[model samples]
Target: MRYAYYPGCSLQASAKEYDLSLKAVCNRLDIELVELKDWNCCGATPAYTVDPLLAMGLSARNLALAEAEDLSVIVAPCPACYKNLRKAGKALEEDPELREKVNDMLTEHKLDSIPKVKLPLEVIASDFDWDALEVERPLAGLNVACYYGCPVARPKGGFDNREAPQAMHLLVEKLGGQPVPFAYDTKCCGGGIVFTRDEISLDLTAKLLTKAKAAGADCLSVMCPLCHLMLDAYQSQAVRRLDTRFDLPALYFTQLMGLALGLGREELGLERNMVAPFSLLERMGLKV
Candidate 1:
């Protein structure tokens, strides 16, 4: 099950832990990830707001590279990247004139055909045989709140339900972890405005933390790095702003899967998480 892997900008720097854990889990599942060489930024959220064509072209450039690689499917770990790539791919495939315009922007590589853009969750859920994989350490007593944030199940026609996604929940169940009934699973974490309007972002992040904690979730299983950053990295700020205690740990879903698969903490980059899950893991009787 080989697919083109695009780590995007966040995974290389702020979300290295996600990249590490994703690779570890993929390796364990025998899912080969051929990373596209010289892959550029997917333009994330900023470029599209500034100029729609520029955003499409930026994402289309990466798609052109994947087409060159002869891979039918391109899997992006970052939801923002996946959204951009998927949007651009669909636009290009539907409109020939738009494809020509974008191709003109690409001086070096022209997109003959845009590859199918997919989220890491989409690839993992559809490809693997869950029953065959041995679960060395089942997450028996752990309660996880799967957070999709925005962009993950958005823009419609994607893998999961845009309003009510259940892919992460099913994966949690498969890993022997109980998926808590979280109402704000698809809620925005204010990641788009975290830098410019931190007050608003903090308020939103605080609310999410509050809800997840209230739901009795031991930790938040997030798919997007931006969501993880707002929930985990900026949790202290959210706590200070709201004058509340939110000692919740935000972990990548891949990290949880790795732990259940008996992969060590070092391999899954567990130490890189801002909110430490050591105590939580200890409670689960799992080695950290």
Candidate 2:
């Protein structure tokens, strides 16, 4: 169950909790994550916008590093990172000329082949045997709104369906938690332009929060770091902008999985969440 791991920029910083919970859950599952040496950023959202070639080169560098390790699969927790890496891998594999140009940019390393880019969600869904998993504290009463954001199921022909994905729902059911029907599950979080056009991002995030709350979701189960940032870190701004009272907590799916597996709060980095779930967990008779 070993795979080359890419934490990306967000996971190392603003989304550190995601990284922490992911490692904790993986450790429990006996999944070994061999992180790539000298791994760099995957260019995230802004790289391609500035220069398409540069974006490919940046992501390709990391792929080259992974290829050097001889690992066939590389898992990126951040959706943006996954999207960039996946795009770069596909481009480099399909277009030899483009790969050469990008290789020229990578003077120190050459990309003979690119590794398969997978999201952490994809890894958990495809690799693990759900029936064999031990759930010490089942999420019996919790209703989770599994938000995939945009990039996760996108660029098509991936693991889950582009329109109606069910991996998260199945995982929630497996953990004894109810997965609420969320129409905006694939909606854009406006994370790409969140910094430039904050108003648009806030409005979009507010809509998601309002919709999730209306659907009776106890909390949002998210997999993307940017989506989590928009939904959790900037939730207050969204609420204030909309003049609404949506105090929904946005949690990484790994965090919820850790809780179901009887992992401690601190172990999962639960305290780092902007909108704390302590009250919600306490209400559900779950330890905080």
Q: Which residue runs of candidate 1 sit more than 4 Å off their true CA positions?
A: none
Taking all chains together, the TM-score of candidate 2 against the true structure is 0.96
**Candidate 2 wrongly placed segments (more than 4 Å):** none
Kindly give the stretch of ten consecutive residues in candidate 1 with the minimal lDDT sum. 150-159
Question: What local distance difference test score does each model get?
Answer: 0.90, 0.90
For candidate 1, lDDT tens digit of each residue in 124-148?
8777777777889999989999998
